[model samples]
Target chain A: MAKGLDIGTMNIICSEREEEDVVFTQQRNAFLELDSSDLTETMLDSAKVLYIERDERIYVLGEDAFKFATIFGKDARRPMRYGIISPKEKDAIPMIKLIVERVLGEPGYRNEVLCISSPGEPIDLDMNPLYHKKMMEALARRMAYETHVIDEGLGVIYSELSDYNFTGLGISMGAGLTNVTLAYLATPVMSFSIGRGGDWIDEQVSITTGLPKEHVCATKEKGFKLGLEVEYGSADGALSIYYDALMTYVIKNLNRKLAEVTPPKVEFPVALAGGSTLPDGFLKMFERKLREAELQIDISKIRLAKEPLYSVARGCLIAARTHEGEEIGSGGETEEGAG
Target chain B: MDNTSSPGILQRGALIYYVGSVTFAAGIALLAVGTAFITISRIHYGSEPEKIILSVISTGVGTTLILTGINMMMKQTRYGYYIVGASAFISLLALLIFTSNYPHNWFYPLISYVLTLYIAGFLALLGNAFANVILWMIEGKPEAVVGREREIKIYTDEEIERDIEEATRKSIELSASELKFKEPGVEEVKLGKTFRETRGNITKVKDDIGEAKSLRKTINPGERMKSGSVEVESVSRNLGEILRKGAVQKGRFGKIKEEIKDEMKKFYSSIRVTRNR
Candidate 1:
């Protein structure tokens, strides 16, 4: 069986086909460090919180880490920031490795093809994704899986725009980065990322409202829709402001990038997928921004992925399946049988 | 051989060229029919995105093939082979897109027949290009080919493996020192002696003093003590020299500081004198 792994800043999701159904497993990509003690260890055990012990310290992982952070009034440390491994977080590598392992589990078979989604080099940041890509590859190889890296935005296209003949624009508004891909008939014409996303919104809102970033994030995720009115100094109101700004930034870059490349003169159906796009009216807000920008290329429609968070994983699955098919065609064998 | 020296259009090369041309024309006709089929499907389906996309792709491929075919026939140069090769690859890609669109419908008679026809057309296009390449190669290395001659080499598996091993060996030799330097996990302190030697020397010096004390019981205690004292004095003298060298370096630093202070004093006095004036 082939697998798809989406290593996002906020989450690590794995998608695989089991029999006739597709199974998705996920974990929040955050951890909280606590001083290791017998009492605390017993408490964690009683709570059944996922954690690992190293250097005499306990790291609470996944969603439980967020809960722990909230209870302690501390910030949850993320393994990634701005779509890549955080340089400031010393434990980013080990933390991400453990989370990916938990999410992916053991491959169905040895050397199973695992297609990983990697963000493109951000146009606005002086960051290179090569090291991160190689690190993910190394992790996958350590798990005895053959790995292939797919552009995160292109993965979205494969997941959502198959019916459009894969000719459209796919944008993943993730937590740390927004990836954009222009694909024509399954071929990526151009792809890039911006180093601003949900986390940026949370931070900006936090700064404006004098609230903790974690508190702001919690408020934003607590089912507030975009374009909703709230108290002037409230978290939701600040969130709305930042969300608008983020949309404007994305649309402006879209215009600037589209001007540099001549895409085929066809109306493109844009697919938005990621955690950031989950809020209600995100598509409507993005559509408004795109209309205001008045890009040269025609846009047929803009829609959200059915499962925004799982879209990249699903795309990776599709890509892995394609690769498996090619491998089978080339007379490669598996333990069970030829797929 | 000169072109005039060869038997005219009745030659095998000419025959293959004619056959390629005919096959290409037939393949193009089939692609045109495929486009029409796509259009009909779109009409029946109320212009669905997938059908429309398929129609556009088929029409585009059909148009490209026609243009390339005209270019090849009119130019009649080896460059036509290049165009044909590119078109053949594109047609195969188109076939892949077309097949993937309705993968489950391959069992349906209409879909199966259309797919078979498309495959046949693609093969014909590919075959035409292959035949043209053979004709070009067989006609002789013509002067009008207009480029540097190309060389194609085929290596056996063993030869390829040997070459790779040779390259790996060279790379390993080149990077040996880099790998060795990088192996130390922590930053190494550069010193005149290895840590082990420095540690062993200190222990040996202590052992020598202890041995001298032990010898005092067997020999003249005063003489043994004098020899041990001489050894200690020499060691202390070397340490004193090192300390003296460090003091000299510190003195140089102090001298530079004193010079700076004097310059500051002079500047301040000059300012005071001007103020007084």
Candidate 2:
């Protein structure tokens, strides 16, 4: 059996193939610490809030954390920032492990292959994702599964660009970082992360508006759209402003990064994925930016993934399927080492 | 006309321009008030030389901000970012000066510290706002800045070899764990359901282990020779026989080793090492 796990900064999603259809399970990668009290515990239990009690502190986990943070006007603590395990969050490891287990469930069988999406090396930040990837691999191993680490952007390609012979540009505008991959025949020619994404927008909006990061995040996720005029002082306005800036930054870097490489002479089809791209008019805004960028390479088309939020997980499943096939063909010995 | 500067782009750019202008005005107003406060206090209180020096410095900074703001508004160059950065630095300096000089009394320092913080906060906000606006305005404009290369990890040959060796070792371990033996013609029909391993797996495992052991011996024969003279003599004798065999003709064994070496180099060079992490 094969499974795909997209360990995103904002959400952890798992994909499992059941015959012809693929099913997905997701959990918000966030938590909130509330005061420990019997009444609070009773209230949380009555509300059915997903939480854990440790050392006399009630830590609300997953989607409920966002709700509680918004209620309390506090920022939801993230287990990951900028597409890796957050150094700022003290309980990132245990929290993320619990969240992953909740979302991924148990492996179908022992040594079931689990392909996890990991962000590529960042271009704009001095961060090493190896530690994050290894931690995730170890977590998967401890759960009694073989793990494969695939590039986040490459996962988008596998999910959305099969018609292009897996040759195209995949951009995952995730919460923590925008991962970009230019692939040919399912092989990544170039891949890197921009170190800024939805979280950056939330932080920027929070700083500008004096709103808690969670409040800004809620506003952004609550029916926000790009290319629409909003009140300049409002949270949605700030979100839109930063979203524009983020798209421009991504395009500029894409142009510059693409210039450095000698890519195959093909009209590349670009596919966009991730939660950040789910906002209305996002594709149109991104297309506008791409047109303005006047990139040196030919772009055949710009398309959004059918399900941007699940694309990475689905792509991971595709990869895991192929990897499992290869392992079977090789008599249970894969060329790639266990990650 | 080029689509790069369409009405939509211009409208967006214009909005940012106005925002930048407003932020610049607010920053200049704060700096102007700060400069006026310093001047008024220095003159009314007949301040010390240090106070006079600070007043002059504040005047210079206030003037610089106005001039830079005007210059940036006109030119919209990369220097706009530098101006905002310099303003921020000046704000920080003013805060440090105010706090250190007025250390004796909390009441006096608190008021000035709050004012400085307000100025610093405005400057920081302005810096961010200006950076975004300036970046938007300068879209697609190329600059020959150095060291902007993507930080993709390029592994050295040694690192690549180490990774391959690690993978091979894991493959060997997997082979060992999943190994199965079959006796020819002994319940051959029943073997179909229970034979979890393939015949080729055994052969491949044997070949890989034998090759690895031989390579290890060839690379570090001295380690084995250190144990005892008898072992050393045996290794020397084996080496002599191999040398004699190779001397007679370019044997398949020697050719295979050379081919493996060549293949290793090719593999190392062909693999594009993008994933360093």
Candidate 3:
């Protein structure tokens, strides 16, 4: 069986097909560090915490880390920041490996195909995605899976645009980044990402309102409506303000980038996916922003993925399945490598 | 037209005028012959003066056709074919009238009408051909402009082989350089610890802790008091030293607890800022 992995900032999800069923397994991609000591070890051991030891330090990982942090009245730290491996986190690689391993488990067979989703180069940030992509590929390869890298936005297209013959615009509003891809007939013509997304909105709202980032995050996730006027004092109001700004910024950049390339003259249905797009009224707000921006392309419709958070993983699974078929048909000689 | 000029370059206007002049001269000759025949018949056979006038009218109509053709050719008019058609019609009408007058000898008028028709048709065709030629001349031939030619060096077979060999050599060198630029794979990456083993260990520790707590809760107070008295009797010999040591240990424990409480307070305060907000 082939696998699809989405190494998202907030969560890491792996998808595999079991007969006619598509199974998804997820783990929070966060951790908390504790100074190593006999008492601490004993306490953690007694509590049955999932952790790793590096440099004589014990690090609690995944959802358990968040639970421990909440109990201890501290914040859980992320191994990935802004949709890539955190350069500031000393244990980022090991932590990611642990999370990925748990989610993917042992490969069903040697050289099992695993297509991993990678974000496009951000237009607003001076960050190179090569290191993160290579690290993930290396980790998956170490586990004996022949890996392929696919753009996160294109993954959404693969999952959602099958009805359109993969001709559409796919936008994945993830936690740390928003990826946009314009694909025609299953081929991507243009793909890019912006550095602003759910996390950026949370951070901005937190700063503007003097609230904790977690509180803003919780409020946003708890169904704060956008594209409506709201009083300006509350956390939800601040979140709504930033959400509007983020959407406008995304639309403006999409327009500018689209102007640079000539795409085929066909109506493109825009599909929105990922965690940030899951809130109520997000698609409506996005549509409003899109109309206000007056983009220079025909948009047939604006759609939301049925399961926004799982779309990338599901699309990656579809891609892996396609690659597996090609390999089998070609007698395993031609391997689809990363672009 | 100048004799030195190529016939291909002759202006269509001049050619039309030349054809028109020839047709006019032929029409005048025909008119003069018809007029003379009418005058001779009137003088020798005492033909009617009205017949002579009719012949004169025919001559006048022929003169009008010739003049119309000349005007069309001179003006380079597109309506030149109408002149030729009118000429043919007038000639046929004149022949019909002449035959009705001389029913016994129709051959002469018939031949003249036939000749007139032939001349009219020829003029029409010539006018059409002239118009086409004028159009073609006005739409001049495309001129071929020769810009500076690139110097193409023709290589001998030996030279071609040498160049190919040189290109192959350069490609090999390029590949070698590319290999040098290739990045090395990561070698020291370490995987983190598994969740299941840690969970198992924690479960065992939890069970042990639970058992210890339950056992402590279930112990009887009377048995505990008896054990405490026995323990006190056993430690009575070094009770003063033990008491001093216990006092020092309690003070140290207090300091450590205070520090831990302060640290916990800091951690809680850092994460609980949302409450203040």
Candidate 4:
């Protein structure tokens, strides 16, 4: 499998003090070079492990695993969901498993200790072992049946949240789910993601349009904004229905969360992340909806994370790092010499 | 007529002429140097007259050598098989004449020893000329300048010297085209392609004649002027009747004499230039 892909939901978070955003670079347009961290290690003796966090799944790899998927991992354009996998978490395992195989290039350089990411707080007190098990079983299968196996817990770590010294809410608004994580101490404290993201919006659009889900998905990227302010009864009438449905749902969710919650209140500013939030005027739409719901926050406080496309991976990097920023493996400090 | 039009042969002559002139000047100096030795040999030892004579001798030798060396280096160039051959012949002749003229004191040695050496050198040069000619005949080198003379010839005037240039230009076109066609597998004939194509009415008439012959052959001859195989008697043809013809109706002899007698006429000469190979 060459650079397999994962698909997930994307959402935009609008709050009272923050206008939703995704800050990629700074006031200066200059962008720093993207690090080849996923594929490299600082020291030769240190074993390299790459962690990829996608909307639906998390990919973990070691050694030249990232390079194994080099062909499919063409940065020229990262495949959001361009292949066999639907816009879902199942995509990530195959994506990373293929990535590992691709990087190694030679045969027999593969190892199969599998893991996948779960939602922030699991919403339910009980762990749904069945659902996670199914996802991991599928992940292991994608790895073509190797030995070792494991499950990684959903991470809420420090030092990985805000590389820019930002202390705001970081949201992974994906296609079928929404996750919000706050950063202070350079890492996210509480993060929660559920099935209420871009895919849901597209689904509503599709239900109204009687079109396929894929069509609705494409329309969100391009046709979503073009349908606004125009009469709803045009040929885009059904799509408008999906649009209204998403807007209403997003508003309700924001209102319920913000109005109901008190002490564990979010930080003043909030940053939006994820691929689904890439349309024009998306922030304004969220803001207007938030204001109408009487749940508006500081519009100026919002910022968009850089490469909303790679927030999870970046956050995963931060989460995967040790106190010294040198990433610690699953083995404790005692095994530091082993790697 | 060709002689009048293009001074092609003349230009080639001019090139050789220039070279010969320079060589001639140098040979004169060399001869003078040789003569100085004579003066030096007659001088008295330790006398002031000996010093003066020695200086004179030195001047003579120095002047001759400098001039001769310069001339040889300038135009001992490789022209073409034909032209080089001609120049080589001329040089040998000049060498003989120049070497023959000194007093017996110097002349005997120059004639016997030096002249023998010259003959051998001349034979070697002739061998070079023969080989070059053979090479051109078999596998021609486009660098050969012999053919280019026709072009140079046309550039000179016979009638009005200015008009002569057009003739020279035309000649180059002709010669260049001729070579190009004869050189099978060639695609371009440089200036010659245009000239071959612009033959005007001459080619048109030829084409017409061909078409007419083919058309006439399609008809059986029996239907025309067949006075059925009558007499085999030979009759005296009337030369007087032919002589009574108009000015334009003259026979071939008249046409031959129409231009300068005995000279083959042409509107132009041929010359070709190629990048130095």
Between the candidate structures 3 and 4, which one is better when assessed by TM-score? 3
For lDDT, candidate 3 versus 4, the one ahead is: 3
Task: List the pairs of residues colliding in candidate 2.
Answer: none
lDDT of 3 by residue, A1-339 (tens): 688899999889888776446677877898888777778777877776777665677788877887788777788889998799999887688678878887888899999999999989788998967678777887888798998988999999888877777789999999999999999877888888999889999889888999888778878877777748788698877877888888889999999889866799999999999999977989998887787777888898889997898889888887886666532233233222211
Model 4 lDDT tens row, A24-120: 1101000111233323322211333233333322233332222333433421112122111233443343443333233212212253222222344
- Please give, for residues B129-206, the per-residue lDDT of candidate 3 as tens digits: 466456445644322011112365897786688568557844764454322122246444322434654211100001
lDDT of 2 by residue, A178-285 (tens): 999999777788888999999899899889999877677777787888867888688778888899999999999999888766798988999999999998999999
Show where candidate 1 strays beyond 4 Å. Answer: A326-339, B1-277
In order, the Cα lDDT scores of the candidates are 0.70, 0.70, 0.70, 0.36
lDDT of each residue in B110-160, candidate 1, tens digit only: 556655655555565556545545555687645312222235488778668
CAPRI class assigned to model 1: incorrect
Q: After superposition, how far is residue B266 of candidate 3 from its true place, in Å?
A: 79
C-alpha TM-score for every candidate? 0.56, 0.54, 0.55, 0.32
TM-score of 1: 0.56
Report residue A59 deviation for candidate 3 (angstroms): 0.6
lDDT of 3 at A235: 82
Native contacts recovered by model 4: 0.00
TM-score per model (chain B) = 0.26, 0.24, 0.25, 0.23
Question: Which lDDT tens digits does candidate 2 get at residues B126-212?
Answer: 655455456555564332111122355987786688579557845764554333323224221111111122111000001111121
